[model samples]
Target: MRKVLESLQRGAHAGLVLDRFGPLAPTDEKNLPERKDRHLTAVLEAAGSGATRELYALAFERRRSTSDPELSRSFQRSVDGAMVIGLGIASTLEAGLRLHQTYGVPFVPGSSIKGLAAHWCHRVLGDDRGGEHREAPLWRKEGDYHRFLFGTTEACGAIVFEDAWPIPNSIAGANGGLRREVMTPHHLDWQGGKGAPTDFDSPTPVGFLSMVGRYDFRITWNGPPAESATIAGWLDRAAEIVSCALVDWGIGAKTSSGFGRMVEAETGNRANAIATVAVAPVGNRADKRSSGTPARVTLVAARPKGGFDVQEEGRALGTLTLGTSPAGLSPEIGMTVDVQVHNDDPVKPQYKWPVASKPAKSVPPSKRR
Candidate 1:
């Protein structure tokens, strides 16, 4: 097997090599440390060729042309730190990295990109329902903007998030976008719940693969032409939100430990922001009054600093901060109340509840008891 692998020329499929050709220890012998290292090196080297670059180019062209030219947008960005994706995937080496199935290249999955964007939109942007089970407030309504961008359980979304592929020869090494990484587990006994960790225990160093370098991210509008203008506006907002999510919240596996963070490329130029069309406020006619529109908002979640995160008609209206509420009025989660909404500045709207307004009887099932 080793000789057959060695005879294979450059540009062989990396996924095939890693998955099938990986060296394994004999039944009698437990570990062959050097053999595993050599196998990983082979996989990395297989991805570092002009053939992989050409394959990625073809894939990128197909993805870009999947939607209309006018409705699609693409941008370049670089991973800020090591990105470990699909680490839990079963493999002989114990850790695994997601690679392109056919081309054997490192690429970010489209589902991952959309998932991160949706999470950022709900959590950071305040489009939440304030419950353990119902975190996606925007997905509740069929016509909600969030639902339009990122579909509901019933229908598909209007926009398509494409996988991000690495730029040709972006990194200095021969491994292309692939990087070797290691994780040392120190407290084996304590983790197994057998005994307390001691200094005398030996640490096991596990090897894995990660990714770094620039990648092209693309998003396209896939809705009807009649709704193109409105969908385009939402797509513009989504692109910005996705960028913020990648930089702030990160993506892929092990984000809390600083994996999968990305930032815009420092090329001093950016793709033109998607053109936005003016959209009429969506909701009841009475909610659009001139003086100050009255709205029934739900207390989604409490802010860490002060005040509550409120949502109206399944749309996030930003944070509602109040120094003090009227007497006999105590704010609670899942409670709905009437508030006056001022949209003079459409970008950032203001919310004000009258002193007469009181909490409505819309408490969540858990809160009722």
Candidate 2:
């Protein structure tokens, strides 16, 4: 099996390799842990070749262009942290990753997206009914927005949530759309119900595949043309709900652990209200913004190599490379920092270190000789 896996040329389907060709360790082997580590490392390395990247790029392009401008509203989002989908799927390594069957790239399934939105609508948006012990039903029977948008068990919805694919070159790493992650379980015996959890328990570190990058989400209206205006309003609202859900509640496995949060990326067109819901322009000319204007940007994530992926409000401001800490402040995820914008070209704005306020000179104490 190992020889067969090695013989396969580069760019082979990563999902196939991980699921089918992964090396196994003997149960009684003394070096089982070492073998497992080696196997996971090899799998991680094999999954991120140049050929796979090209394939992902092609797939992204094709998917992005497929939705009709008139019928569909598309938006892009940058993942705020690591996202793991299909984590329960059986795998030799005990952790699973969902990848595109054809392109072998990480993607958010449309069904999953819809499910998250639906759940959010039911729990958060649904209006409260009467009873003291009661909450809002799945949806109200009369003029139910949820029913119209997501549809009932009897009928299909007016809108379709398309599968989300990553933006090309968005993931800041050599790895093709995937990141290697580790999970350490400290109380395995407690979890197995064999013993009480204690600090002295040995921690088992398990490696898994996760993703961090920009993902393009699309939702299209396919209902009656006569009702387009009404549906468009609903679609816009739906987009906002989904955006809020992605950013707040998150999606996919381990969301409670902050695994799938995403923020809206900048878009050129404001006409598509659905796409422009959460994103804010960095320094719009209409705002009388000029070069070197200080702007507050949020640190989204640290780049694998160096620097940090920063965003203004929800709009992505691109990677900020710093040879030294600005104002002697270290960059950390989710921290907001003020930066000077070099907006000579509005399309490709550059962020510079904020003009540091000079510190007050300390007064020399008079010597009492």
The TM-score, computed over Cα atoms with residue i paired to residue i, of candidate 2 is 0.64
Q: Model 1, 162-232: lDDT tens per residue? A: 88887766743588688888889999889999999999889988778899888888888764442334445
RMSD of each: 13.5, 24.4
Error of 1 at 277 (Å): 16
lDDT tens digits by residue: candidate 2, 238-283: 6786776787677789988879877667642223223333222223
Local lDDT at 188 for model 1? 81
- For candidate 2, the lDDT comes to 0.66
- Give candidate 1's error at residue 109 in angstroms: 0.6
Which pairs of residues collide in candidate 1?
A: none
Displacement of residue 120 (Cα, Å) in model 2 is 1.1
TM, every model = 0.66, 0.64
